[model samples]
Target: MTPHMSRKTRIAGISLAAAALVAAGITAGTAGASTVQAPTADGSPLKLSASHRAELLRDASATKAQTAKELGLGSQEKLVVKDVIKDADGTTHTRYDRTYAGLPVLGGDMVVHTAKGGAIKSTTKSTKKSVKVASLTAKIAPAAAAQSAQGTVAKSLSAKKADAQAPKKVVWAASGTPVLAYDTVVKGVKKDGTPSRMHVITDADSGKKIFQYDDIRTGKGESEFSGSVDLGTSKEGSGFTLTDADRGGHKTLNLGNSESGEGKAFTDEDDKWGTGKPDDPQTAAVDAHYGAAETWDYYKKVQGRNGIKGDGKGATSRVHYGKNYVNAFWDDDCFCMSYGDGEGDKAPLTALDVAAHEMSHGVTAATANLTYSGESGGLNEGTSDIFGTSVEFYAKNDKDPGDYLIGEKININGDGKPLRYMDKPSRDGQSKDFWDSSTGGLDPHYSSGVANHFFYLLSEGSGPKEIGGVKYDSPTKDDKKVEGIGRDKAEKIWFKALTEYMTSNTDYKAAREATVKAATDLYKAGSPEVKGVEAAWDGVAVK
Candidate 1:
């Protein structure tokens, strides 16, 4: 379908009306009754009580003083702090795009303190407590409400299917998020006999939404009666941008070896990233859909997690973003997916495994929430690659034959060479073949080599093998033939270690311990799964 006529397009249409309501007085800006001014990522703005201001100020000044003294006695470096005061009306939170997430970002509270006097004390951060809206009750404008209600009533009064395509039948969608509004081929008129549009209302914070819209808006001659409906307006003047808001779900990009793409792709006119092409919506949709579906099925059937999170939720994909943008990535805030057209639109990164790989990062973020810096970072990257490959193996499609190379299909090197090689991560020269003190210092994409090799050995065993006609030889660091615990179990152990144990600063050694602990927790300390995990790491020389 064309972008202007898409299902989401219609639902988003009503957002204008919703924005109009904001203009009156129906704004959700009230931060419950005065919330504390602690530094939290809660989307709402912070409001400190009169009594709390002194402590907050003192602490802020103290923290600043300490930081200033650390630098030197005479310092031009200064951190300006704010103390916002509101009238009877509450203040709106300052919403910005999440630096990492693509959605609107909101934050509250920056209490600074000084040393002995007005120097510096400490710093703190916390999100605002949720606005405890006990229940959502609204007196929609009488005219608008009546018009809305009357449309439904009117639809019922004159409900009839178009006399085409075999009358009419009701079919409620059972999966995926419902769009705001759409045009059905032969949906015909509403019950009131008036033609209407369909749309859904989604939660501003989370993308969850419920279906609600005018079913009929008709006027005969001069009698434009909308079921005695009334409309209520707002006082916010106009539309209010949504904060911490997202429109859809994003999946991952699973690669041949199941490596995740980690870089900027394309940028939108608004400076946002995307995957869809400039004008080829249908082909882009098909390519992205098939790739995503293959990935979705891969994780479900192989890992048996039901879906990405073992929760059956589908991953979202965006393709052909910007004019010849290069690269793809996964961010925690998105918890979804995106793609890009390589330089000059030569390649589409929405390949099945690539999409799966990217989406798995989200699963990782939700589960292990691995920090993307050092060893854990590499493991995190490798984890995405591993699953990206696993999802591919599970998909078993034709266009993409199975292989153990990362970015083999994407043409990263422009010579048909894969981006990274798991069997010998150093095959790319940029990645490591074994763990070392400096391994943790390399980029995660390169540092990921050590674990990628471990997974290769553990899944296929350190030797030549054939799966779908592709030959792979996973070599070990010390020529020690180590046994694998199987890909299925290894993936599970890695997942558990990440989601249940890993933290932002976790490094290689810590990762080893965490994985061991996860293996022990999943399958007794000395069980086959645990043993295999140990052997895999050992094969990579991390033992």
Candidate 2:
């Protein structure tokens, strides 16, 4: 369904509303509360003391014996706790990496959820197939594997000084038989000045490259809301620089018109910056700064998380990267977010949702560390979309309100259409409306449709719906109706599932189980929330 009646009319209305708000000098805050309070039926807040909630969320039991027993692992299977998170109800979610015989099992990680009384409740596995390999021995040496991977990457990129990191022994089990393999990283600089870090999975038995992906994740974003924003600045020498000391010291830099080099730090005579247009280089910086602040506020106030890594540290934002580059990305190597001017310098991709989307990649890296391939990659992308939508809503800016539509403000497609539709993902042509084995072959951005649809259904249910003045029509794979548990509850459940129950290699089925476990932990067993999660997953054909 078309989200808005007319893009021009909506933009004009939004501009008018923003003008009126600014004229009245109204400082309407976001819809998010300062404290974390799970909502009850009738919209009443559950009052849990801060100390009590902390106590409940901190206690985690991750003994190897306990995890093994919870996962029903055989005598030959060993478990190592990768991470642990406890919910507000004292239920602990422990993620484990599996080892068979003596080799690390790839794609064999799982999560075990425990109830308040420390009883195992449910377990989510990436692959239901048992962890067992015939042999851990490899015919090919690590040196040979590394050389082969380096050659493969060099040929692909025509790169110079291409070097492959030492190969690590791991079991290859996503498809086919479980066999020994060497995971290698071939690092080099591309002809376009972009860095390339190719993750090459080579079969140790044959020295063949089984799988590979470019480590440099690329994408795009923009800043359309809060038309004229006030950026935070820092005093340097006799001038002010675009560095936000207040919001974890997030600084914005210019990459000039080239793809390389740290261009320059935006500086001004006064603390004020930007004219809300690309004519002023600082405008993109302003949007990036505001986005970072708002996203930080959203996590801290709503989720009670201090920062991306909960370490109270900030990341840098680089803008004006490449000539009409048309993309933005979060680089874990630099712990920063970068944006490119789209088409012309007119579209600087620093929109709230875009910024939130890119930064969320960092959060996923720090939390579940979802591998950027197959179903886990799709979940990773969907998690970004979920939080990006949440952040837009949490900001509640007059220019941008919370909606299920993504990339609506940024005309990335040049047709004024949003990048993806959450309610009906198939509207994008490439995105899937339901889960299927073939989804793993699609781009993560496209394969994310199933989970995105599930989130939308969980938030607004199936069938005709209007939210934030936008129209939507959602359909289920099974033609079954779904009842929403509200976006507030849905986001909470997703966040819990992401931080608690999800592991690196979680697939669509595992995601279904994780979200169900999250709902059960937050709400109760057999509650509407739990039932809603199941129904939503069913709507996405996950079952």
Superposition error at 374 for model 2 (Å) = 1.5
The lDDT, on a scale of 0 to 1, for candidate 2 is 0.71
Error of 1 at 257 (Å): 29
Question: For all candidates, what are the clash counts?
Answer: 104, 7
Candidate number with greatest TM-score: 2
TM-score per candidate, chains pooled: 0.49, 0.80
Extract clashing residue pairs from model 2: 219-328, 220-328, 221-349, 222-349, 222-350, 222-351, 223-351
* Predictions in order: lDDT: 0.43, 0.71
Clashes of 2: 7
CA lDDT of 256 in candidate 2?
A: 83
Q: How well does candidate 2 score on lDDT at residue 30?
A: 28
- Give the C-alpha lDDT of model 1: 0.43
**39-110: candidate 1 lDDT, tens digit per residue:** 112211123333444454454445554653542323322333333211112321110111111111122122
